[model samples]
Structures are given as C-alpha cells and as structure tokens.
Target chain A: MRIVVLAGGIGGARFLRGLKAAAPDAEITVIGNTGDDIHLFGLKVCPDLDTVMYTLGGGIHEEQGWGRADESFTVKEELAAYGVGPEWFGLGDRDFATHIVRTQMIDAGYPLSAVTEALCARWRPGVRLIPMSDDRVETHVVIDTPEEGRKAVHFQEYWVRLHASVPAQAILPVGAETAKPAPGVLQAIGEADLVLFPPSNPVVSIGTILAVPGIRAAIAEAGVPVVGLSPIIGGAPVRGMADKVLAAVGVESTAAAVAAHYGSGLLDGWLVDTSDAAAVAEVEAAGIRCRAVPLLMTDVEAAAAMAREALELAEEVR
Target chain B: MRIVVLAGGIGGARFLRGLKAAAPDAEITVIGNTGDDIHLFGLKVCPDLDTVMYTLGGGIHEEQGWGRADESFTVKEELAAYGVGPEWFGLGDRDFATHIVRTQMIDAGYPLSAVTEALCARWRPGVRLIPMSDDRVETHVVIDTPEEGRKAVHFQEYWVRLHASVPAQAILPVGAETAKPAPGVLQAIGEADLVLFPPSNPVVSIGTILAVPGIRAAIAEAGVPVVGLSPIIGGAPVRGMADKVLAAVGVESTAAAVAAHYGSGLLDGWLVDTSDAAAVAEVEAAGIRCRAVPLLMTDVEAAAAMAREALELAEEVR
Candidate 1:
C-alpha cells in the first residue's frame, strides 16, 4: 500500500510513528509543513520537518516529541553569551548540526527538497519526506499588544516565545501565495492509494501547506480517499495551541467545526475522539463521512489502533 | 601613546597579552593575519583574529593559547555524527557561536571589519583588532605528496591535517595581490607612535599582511620606528612550525636571516634572544639596530619583558 501523510510538528510526527507501526510494509511519503521554517543565526530551521524526521528516525527526545535526544545546549548558551538571541527557541547542539548542514547545502544552491533528501540519507527516516514547498513560506501571526498594538510576528515568536497566550488577530503564511509545492509532493499525492492528514494544527500546520498555490488543489483532485484525524479532543487540542490558531482563522475549537472547515469537497472522512462521539453526526450531516474513535495517542499501541480506525474509515468512504 | 602590532595565531596572541601588560596606557591596534581564516561548515573561522580577541578578552584557553576556555565539542561531535566534516580542525561549541554570529552578519551585508568590531563589542578585547584585509585572502601552501603529486592546499590543511611535516614548495597568499588593507589598518600603521612585529610566523603570518597592495608601503613610509622580535629562538621557532614556511619563502630559519629578509629599510630594529646574541651584529651590520634580550615567553611577565625590550629598541632606533 502507498500512503501519503501531511504532517506538522509533534502531533503529526507521533501519529506517523503509529502509522508506520500499523503498516510496516506500506510505502509512506510524508509531505511535511514548511511554514514554521525560520532562519535563526543564519541557519535554516524547519521545526515541523525536523520533528517528523527525528521522530521517525529514533533520534527524537521521546518525552518532548520534538528536538533530538541526549542533546546539549552549549551552542545556544554560547550564542546567548555573545548577545545573539531569540533565546526563547531551544535549538540544542545536536539539532543545530542538522540546521547547519541544511543551511550549508541551501547556500551551495541546492533546493530545500534536495537538501531534505541528502539529510534523510543519514537519518534514514524510512519514509520519503518532502517539504510542502521549497520556496520560503513563513507563517506569521498578527496579535494586539498594549505596547506594540497590532503587529505580525513569526509563527515561532507567536507559538514558542509568547506561548500562544495572546489572542491572534490573524495568521498569515507570508509567501505561500507564490510558493510552489516541493518536488514530488503532487506526484506522491496522485500516486497514493490514500492520503492521511495526521492530527496536526489545522490553521498553521496543514493550513499553511494548503496555502501554497498548487498543493491544496492537487490534494483535492487526487482521486483517492482523503482522511483527517482531529487534533482537537473534546474541545481542547490533543497537543500544541491548535485552538488558538484555529480561532485566528475563525474556526471553532471542535472536531466537527475543524472537519467542516476542511469541507466535504476536500475531506472524504474525518475521525473524532470517542468523547466527541455526538459530533460525528454533525460532521456526517456536513456531507463528509465521520467516525468516533479513541484518538488519544497515549502510546504506540493506542496510536496504532487510531491509525487502523482512520484507514478503516478511509475504506468505508471509498 | 599609539602602538600597532602585526599578529598571527597563538604566538601573536600571547605576545599581545604581554604587550598589553607592558604598555597598559597605550592604545594598541592589531593588524590580525586573515591568511589563516577559513570557512568550515559554512561558518567563517577567523583563527588569528579570534585568538587575539579571546586572548585579550580573557576567554582563551590559557594552556592551549587559542580557542575558548571551558569549551564543549558537542557541535563538532554532532557534525561528525552527520558525516559532515573536515573532522580535523577542533571548533568547540562556544567557538561555533562566534562563527555563526560572524557568518550571519556577513550574510546580512556587513563587511568582516564591521563584523569583527561587532564581535569585539562583546569580547571587549581592549585592542582595536582589525583583519589585515576585509577581502578574502587565504594562505595556500604547495606541497608534493606521493599520492596527489604537487598541489596547493589551504594553510589549515597543510598545518592542521598534514601537521606541516611535508616540505612546503611555495607559500601563496591567494587573494593578497589585489586585496586592500581593511578599514583603519593602513591608517593605524601611518599614525602609530610605534609599530611591532611579535614572535609570529614571519613568512605566512606577517608576510601575508605585507603582501596586500598598500600595507607594506604604509608601514615603510611611516616615520615612526618599526621594530620586530625574532620568532626563531636560537635556531628553531619557540612554538609552531615556522621553519617549514620559512623554507618555502627561501629564508633560513635563523634570527639574523629573518631580520635580513625584512630588510633594514623596512625594519628599523630587530630583537633577538640572548642565545642568538652573536647574530645581533650581523643584523645591525645590515643597517638595522638589533637587541639581544631574553625572548622566551614562559609566562605573561616574561612576555611583558620582551614587549618592553621591543619598545626600548624602538626608542633606540628613534
């Protein structure tokens, strides 16, 4: 079986781990979101891509579900000592090497897709990982502050620095309008038997990927079952500040609202947590097939079960 | 009082420390050799400038005479893990931060001189440290290897990787022919009350600085006394493999021969160690005043005495 998964950071990467376990023999292609990519200290950092890469490659800090395991902060501490900062973003020494290599290759004129391929040659993430777009596309969040009034900050500044406590006025994928899908993204979707949208932030993670010119249209027209797992459990995000960003895009923080936001034309099936079983009727009423399952990714086995349910739902939709 | 010093890596940094101790009230401007500056992992590693800066700033590894004290090699270890490396040059985590900040500033359109100044703002190295040239000028050494035949390699590869054991066929300052001295370099030499060449590599270090288009002329035309301390002690360098490069430039590794290589017109005074006292007459006979002093820099105090002797020799020439 050929599977194409659209992934964001932690939540998506964790889900991918379960998906790989659920179907070990299946050929998996991950279309990782690149809107969270930022250049800090002149090193290109793709948080979402790195998260997925580390998670699948067994190098991820298992508890944090993001950065590298056994990491050191000597580089970051030294950078801070030199008064070079955005000290909020914790890029560990081990993780910095990945960014350094990626940036070096990019500076040498290799496109991000080619760089990603080269990086994977070392990690051997067991899946074909490609970014949503090779072109720069930074996600920015507009927020109101008593001091600064209305201003757009990089998604990382909004999410990591501010902790998403402030109300987001708007979320913008700055360069997505002009960005093209990275090489093999559309072809991967077209060739896949099914497409899975892992429980990632709808507004900034999967939403930003869709914002790219060709990606959303290609996924919508792929002629294969398009399944999505809700990042929202009950009315709260399973992980991350997905609800805060969802509000910026005017979507309610509910499994049904998230499904309706993606819409029937684009989504073939949607999976809600067992607690939100009542919302399955509302989601199905909106013309997309819906299933309520125990979607809490408590462990690999539990997550694998969730993946199995999503695939079953995909079969039902087909 | 204004003092100008031409410097290289470890030896020059140690001498500068002594010079600072000897003439604390003097405003010292260091013309750091850029010939040893290299790009490793896409970050500019200015070994000579950093040694001077770190030595003066009290961040240098005292025993090693270069790099940062209490440094961690996490970044280097991680880079090696990624199979990306020269793996020979030891750049610690703290040192990586300096290069990262420098590379970022350079990429943002700041010249190396401005970037060096900005870095110094944090290091507070006391001296006004300027690279010999803002332009890229790498020292290359031609060597004959049984496997590669005759070829030119970067100075770092020749010294660090090969240990400079092979005889250097030629020493070329790759970009020095067209390179202009960095901002404030020529002016510092022109307006100096005194100029001193510390116990640094005569061929690759100070010689590369002189190779720049207008720097040698500025120093020669400066009316103030130009003095130098012999790097060669008795018949060998006190530290480093200066003999290999000295041979490349066809100068015997002797105190008098090095003084004669500078020529009496350029060097007003030359200070040789007391052990090389017999050669003082030969150096003086070439129309330059020569002093025989205890030149062994066993400690900062000893180095300070050497600096004081150079200053006295400058007064004698005046």
Candidate 2:
C-alpha cells in the first residue's frame, strides 16, 4: 500500500517510527514541515526535518524527542564566553554540526530539497522524506509584546524562547503563498492510497504544511482516504503548545472541534482518542467517518496501534 | 593615555589581559584580525576575536588556550548524528551562540566593528575590541590537496584539518586587496600613545590584519612608537605553525630574521626573549631599537613584565 504522511516534529517522528514498524511493505513518504526551520547561527535548523531524521535513524534523544542523542554543548559555552549568546534555545555542539553542514550545502547552491536528500543519505530513514517545499516559508507568530506591540516573532522565538506564554494574535507561514511543493510531494499525494496526519500540533504542524500553495490542493484532490489523528484529545493537548496555537487560529481545544475544523471537504476519516468517544458522534455528524480509538501513543507499540487504527479507518472509508 | 593594540588570538588576548593589568586606567582599543573567521554552522566564527574575548574575559580554557573552560560537546555530538559534521574542530554549543549573535548582527547591517563593540560590552574585557575590517577577507592556503591537486583551501581547513603539514606554496587573504580597515581602527592607531604587537602568529595573525589596506599604513604613519615582541623564540615559533607558514612566504624562522622582515620602516622598537639575546645586535643593526628581556610570559605577572619591557623599549626608540 502507498501511504503518505504529512508531519511536524516530535509526535510526527514518533508516529512515523511506529508506522514504519507496523507496515514495512507499505511505501511511506513523509512530507515534513519546514516552517519550523530557523536560521540560527547562520545554519538552517529544520526542527521537524531533524526530528523525523533522528527518530528514524535511531539517533534521536528519545526523551527530548528532538536533536541527536549524546549531544554536546562545548560550542555553545564557547559562544557564551564570547558574550555572543541568545542563550534561550539550546543548540548542542553535535546539533550545530548538522545545521553547519546543511547551511554549507545550502550556501553551496543546493536547494533545500537536494540538501535534505544528502542529509537523508546517512540517516536512511527507510521512507522517502520530502520537505513540504524548497521555498523559505517560516512560521511566524504575531504577538503583542509590551515594547514592540504586534510584532512578528519567528516560530522558534515564540515556541522555544518565549515558551509560548504570550498571546499569539495570529500565526503566519511566511512565503507559503509562493511556495511550490518539493519534487515528489504532490506526486506522492496523488499516488497515495491513504494519507495520514499524525498526532502533531494541528494548527502549526500539519496546518503549516497544508498552508503551502499546492500541497493542500493536491491532497484535497487526491481521490483516496485522508485520515487525521486528533492532536486535541480529552480537552487538552497530548503534547506541545497545540492549545495555545489553536487559540491563535480561533479554534477551541477539543477533538470534535478540531475534527470539524479540518472539515469533511478535506478529511475522509477522523480518529479521536477513546476518552473523547462522546465527541466521535459530533465529528461523524460533520460527514467525516469518525472512530474513537486509543490514541495515547505512550510507546512505539501504542503508536503502532494508532497507525493501525488509522490505516484500518482508511480501509473502512474506502 | 589611550592605547590600542593589534592582535590575533591566544597570545594577543593574553597580552591584552596584561596590558589591562599594566595600564588599568588606560582606555585600550584592540584591533583584532578577522581573517581567521570561518563560517561554521551558519554562524560567523571570528576565532581571533573570540580568543581575545574569552582569554581576557577569564572564560578561556587555560590548558587549551581556546574555547571555554568546563565546556560540553552535546551540540557537536548531535550534529554528527545528523551527519552534519566536518567534526575536526571543537565547537561547543555555547560557543555556537556567540557566532549566531555575531552573524545576526552582521546580517542586520552592523559592521563587525560595532558588533564587536556590542559583544565586548558584555565581556567588559576592559578593551575596546574592533575587527580590522567588517568585510570578508578569508585567509586561504595553496596546498597539494589530494582532492583538488594544489588548490587553495581555507586557512582553518589547512591549519586545523591538515595540521599545516602540507607545504603551503602561497598564503592569500581572499578579498583583502581592496579591503579597508573597519571604522575606528585607523583612528584608534593614530590616536594611540603607543602600539604593541604581542607574540602572535606573525604570518596569519598580524600579517592578515595588515593585509587590510589602511591598517598597515596607519601604523607606519602613527607618530607613537610601534613595538613588537618577538613571536620567534630561539629560531623556532613560541607556539603555532609559524615555521610551516613562514616557509610559504620564504622567511627564515629566526628572531633577527623576523625582525628584519618587519624592518625599521614599520617597527620603531622590538623585544626579544633572553634566549635570543645574541640576535639583538643583528636586529639593532637593521636600524631599530631592540631589547633582550625575559619575555616568556609564564603568568599574568610575567606578561605584565613583558609589557613593561616593550614599553621601555618603545621609550628608548622614541
């Protein structure tokens, strides 16, 4: 079976890890979000791309769910000594090397898609990983700072630096309007028998990917099952600042509300956690097939179960 | 009295520290070389600037004479995992932060001089550290590379990676021909009561800074005594690959030979170590005041003594 997954960081990486285990024979293509990519220290840090790469390559700091395992910060301390520190977001020395190589390759005139391929050559994540676009589409949050008022902060500053405490007035994927899908992204969506949105931050994660010019249109036009796992579960986020991000999009933090947000026009199957079983009826009422499954992915086994449920839901929708 | 010193990395930073201790009330300006600057992980890494900052700020690794004390390498490890490493040079995570800020400031249209001023503010190195130029002038070494067969490689790659083992046919500061001194550099030199060149790598360090058009001319024109302590001690470099680099420039690695190379035109006075006292007559024979003193700076006290000797030599020459 041809399976296409649109993903963000941590949760998406974890989910993809399980999906790979559960369906080895299935052709998996991951369209990773690059909006979370930040130019830090003159290097491109694609959080989502790194998460997927590391998680699949078995180099991930499993506990942190981001960056390579056994990372060092010697470079960071040296920088601090030079008094050239932002010091908010952590960039490990090991992690810095990746950004360095990526930046060097990018500077050498290779498009990000080609750079991603070169990076993946070592990871060999067993799935074809494609960036949503080669274009520079940064996810920016418009926040009302005391001094700057409604200033646009880079997604990392909003997420990593501020810890997302400030009210996000609006979230924008800068350059998404002009972004073209990376080489195989649209083709994979069209060729896919099933499309899955893992339990990542809905509004910022998959939403950012969908915001790209051709991506959402391609997925919507694909005459196949489009399944989305509820990132919002049991009236709270399973992980990350999804609730805060959803508030920026004016969506309430609930599974049925989020499912209804994706809507029937784009979604064929919606999988909510069993705890939100009551909301399953409401999601189904939106004309999308809804299943209340055990969606708390505590481990790879649990994640596999969720993937299995999503794939099963896809078969049922078909 | 206001004093400014031209410097490179370790020796320069260490000497500046003593200069601060020797003349505590003097407003010291440091015209640091940016030729050793390398773009690693998307950040501009001014090794000499950082070395000066770290050494003076008490953050330098005492044993290593580079990077921070008690540094960690989580970032490097993480970067390697992501297959993003040349992995030769040690860049700690904290060190990465400095370059990030420098790069950001540079990108934001701040000349390296101003950016350096901002950085030195936090360091409070008691020295106004300014880059010789804001422009990019990379030092490259022409070597018989196995990959390219006698192509020029970055100085860092040649020095750190190849350990300067290969014979350098030529050492060129790329883009230096038209490069001018950064704002404040010439003014700082012109205004100085005295100028001192510490025992830094003569070729890449001081030579590279001098490669910037206005700086060497400014020093030559400055009415104040221009004194340089011998980097060559007893027919060998005090430290570094000076001997290897000197071969490229066709200069002999002797205290007298090096002093003669600088000549009476640029140097008003020169200080040689007690071990090279015999070479003093030869240096003095070249029409410049020369002194032989205990120049091995074992500690801050010793470094201060060296500074005093250089000052005395400058007074004699004047």
How much does each candidate deviate from the true structure in C-alpha RMSD?
1.2, 3.2
Per-residue CA lDDT of model 2 for A240-285, tens digit only, reads: 8888899999999999888888889899999999899999889888
In TM-score terms, candidate 2 sits at: 0.89
lDDT of 1 at B174: 98
Chain B TM-score (each prediction, in order): 0.99, 0.97
Give stretches of model 1 more than 4 Å off: none
Q: Candidate 2 at residue A316, lDDT?
A: 95
Give the per-residue lDDT digits (tens) of candidate 1, residues A1-318: 999999999988889999989989999999999999999999999999999999888999999988999998998988898899989999999999999999999999999999999888888999999999999999999999999899999999999999999999999999999999998999998899999999999999999988998888888998889999999998999988888999998999999999999999899999999999999999999999999999999898888998999889889988
Top TM-score: which candidate number?
A: 1
Question: What lDDT score goes with residue A190 in model 1?
Answer: 89
User: Where does candidate 2 stray beyond 4 Å?
Assistant: A40-42, A63-94, A140-171, A241-254, B82-85, B144-151
lDDT of each: 0.93, 0.86
